[model samples]
Target: MSELLAIAGLDCSYGEVQVLHGIGLALAKGEVLCLLGRNGAGKTTTLKAIMGLIPATAGSIRLNGRELTGLPAHEVPKAGVAYVPQGRRLFAEMTVAENIEIGLMARGKGKATRDMVLGLFPRLAERLNQRSGTLSGGEQQMLAMARALCLEPEVLLLDEPTEGLMPSMIEKIRETVSKLRGLGVSTILVEQRVEAVLAVADRVAFIENGRNRETMTAAALRADPAAVKRYVGVG
Candidate 1:
């Protein structure tokens, strides 16, 4: 596996108050790397920094060997990084089809592109005419991921994808992620569900007190329950 996304000595702050400290991680092509930690452990901030939602105060962020340190958030997607934020921020008033159209706008205007996205997420095919806000939580999450996929990203940054969903819904998300991995799309999953994270991740990185603590293969973390519980509040 080749390195696709790399963050070295990354740091970020909010108005002089630092939230991340010397955090670093890497994503390989076709791999799923999960970030595990309790709340306020700087998980979201790290994603934001990588996506350029918040500027990095120091260090480097690279995608596919291209330096992405100072790029703006909107430009990050063009560089092959798409972010599916925690809230599943879809346009409530927009129909599912219309919402997907908004996503197509990122890559370019093409009917084939629309077809590709709809094809990937067949569930969205059925709700094309329905308003996004009316969709269930799982469905909305699907829309969010589908919308980002329209950009045709090489790597996806997902934040707490299964946070507030039923077990069945979580299964759907897990299946979707697994399918994406098979298609050669690497992903960085920031999740609170330790079991699910370990189940889907190829590798795991633990972040604590705003810094990288330990990183290991998914198998190792699962085998050591005490290790998982120490940092992520789970075992």
Candidate 2:
């Protein structure tokens, strides 16, 4: 499992307020690393810094040994890193197909890539012409993931992908994550749904006050229920 993404001495801030402090972690090829923490613990901030959505005051972000820090957010995807942000952020007025096309255009991809994503979320295939805003929450999430996949990224950054949804919808999102892992897509998953994310994650990192507090194998966390509860507040 070669390293796919690495962060060292990461520090980020919003204006005068600092968030992340010397955060560091490494993700391996085809591995799923879940970031577990309570709100304001800097989980989302970590993803933003990785994607260059926010400036990292100091640190290194590398993808496949290529430096990615200081790259603009739009260029991040071209470097084989795609972000599925917390809110899904789909174009409300655009049809499902149109939303996917946007991602294809960004990466200079074509119908082949689009078809591959649709294959992963067959529900999106059925609603290709439907407006994204009109779709259910789960459908929107599927579209979001599908759009991100259109880039054929080497590393996918997922921020609370299962935040607001019913049990069935949560299952669907989990299935998608599992499928991505099976397809050998490396991912950094920021999730509050402990069990669901753990099911697909190979490793887990706990964050507090914007610092990485602990990192261990997912199997180890699963084996020790007390650790899961203490770090993530769920088992």
lDDT of 1 by residue, 1-235 (tens): 5689989999999998999999999899889999988889999999999999999999999998899999978899988888999999999999999999998898785788788777777888999999999999999998999998888888998999998998998998898899889888999999988889877999999899899999999999868878788997755
Q: TM-score of every model?
A: 0.97, 0.97
C-alpha-based local distance difference test score of model 1: 0.90
lDDT of each: 0.90, 0.90
1-235 in candidate 2: lDDT tens per residue? 5678989999999999999999999998888999988789999999999889999999999998999999988899999999999899999999999999998988899988988899999999999899999999989999998999999999999998888889999988888888888888989999887778667888999998999998888888878767767766765
User: Candidate 2 at 141: error in angstroms?
Assistant: 0.2
Clash list (residue pairs), candidate 1:
none
